[model samples]
Target: MSHKIIRSLLEGRLKAWAAARSPALRIAYQNVVFSPAASETYLRAFLLPAGTNSNDLAGAHRLYTGLFQITIVAPAGGGTGAAESLADELAALFPLYDRLTKTGFSVQVMTPVEPGPEQQGDTAFALPVSFQYRADTT
Candidate 1:
């Protein structure tokens, strides 16, 4: 239950940010059906929940941690400048120590956003950006 709430809160933030952009970027959410146009730039969001554990012997407190990753997909041969700029914006969106709270649950961004190596395929370049998050419950 807590995991679902955490995911919702985090994903909500990302969705809102994307929607508010000047030229909204299409997003492929987990398990959602989405097909971008051939030359379009978009984003893919993933929530990788590590697991939840009791914070104490009493089991009254719990801790949840996970990695949230977003991949920026751009047209091949378009150069990396656009992808890199988007990565920078995403990193700023979820800065270290940021906190998200809803319905009495709170999640914190535990690390700086990190960008992974770019992967080039026949049709697109995929740049992955990710960060760690932690949530605590009583």
Candidate 2:
């Protein structure tokens, strides 16, 4: 329940931001089929739940933690400049200690957004930017 709300809150923010970009970046959301045209750059979003644990003896309090990842996929052979720039923008979007709340659920960014090493493939280069998030509830 809370996990779903957390996902919605985070993904909604990403979706809104993408829609407002000048060229309107496309995002391949979870379980959605997205086929970008050749040479088109896009993003893929994933929510990886770390786990949930009871925080109190009576299980009245709980803690949820997870990693939210966004992968930037750009055409192959293009230097990493474009991908890196987008990564920077995304990192800034979810700053450390930021909080998103909805339906009585609140999730906080637990770490600075970190960009992983680039993964090169025949058709595209994927640079993943990820951050940790935590939520608490009673």
Candidate 3:
């Protein structure tokens, strides 16, 4: 499948996660909401093609590298650690090594490149997460 399809799936998963925590966290960003207007909560999932090389079609199938960036944003109210709480809920949605697969492509692994940020600033919390997945575009 194309990267666009994969991205849509990722967005769906993110929205589903937020919906599950609507009552407690009140996640406002069902999609990737990035705005200065500011209500309270926001989240965005961005996917980019990191790099692609021949994984060898000689075997049976062809594999490609698909990297994605997931950024979760939340309000930073007071010094009361509101952002951290949001981060925790967000983390629960995408646990380590979560496997996401679809037709014509499959994510063999989802690995975090770096530690997710707990807080971005005094106004909002940002969790920047990266993952590399292997896609079989056969």
Q: Write model 2 residue lDDT over 20-39, tens digit each, in one string.
A: 99899999988988888889
Alpha-carbon local distance difference test for all models: 0.93, 0.93, 0.58
- TM-scores for all candidates: the values are 0.97, 0.97, 0.66
lDDT of model 2, residue 121:
97
lDDT of 3 by residue, 1-138 (tens): 456666766656766776776453333333545454364665556677655555565765555667665665666654435545655555565666776666645464466544365555866767666667666664
The sequence of per-residue lDDT tens digits that candidate 1 reaches over residues 22-113 is 89988899999999999999999999999789978889988999999999999999999999999999989998999999977899999999
Q: Return whichever of 1 and 3 wins on TM-score.
A: 1
**Mind sharing the TM-score for model 1?**
0.97
Where is model 3 poorest over a 10-residue stretch in terms of lDDT?
23-32
Residue 46 error for model 2, in Å? Answer: 0.2
Which pairs of residues have clashing backbones in candidate 1?
A: none
27: Cα error in model 2, Å: 0.5
Task: Show the colliding residue pairs in model 2.
Answer: none
Arranged by TM-score with the best first, the candidates are 2, 1, 3
> How far off is residue 38 in model 3, in Å?
2.6
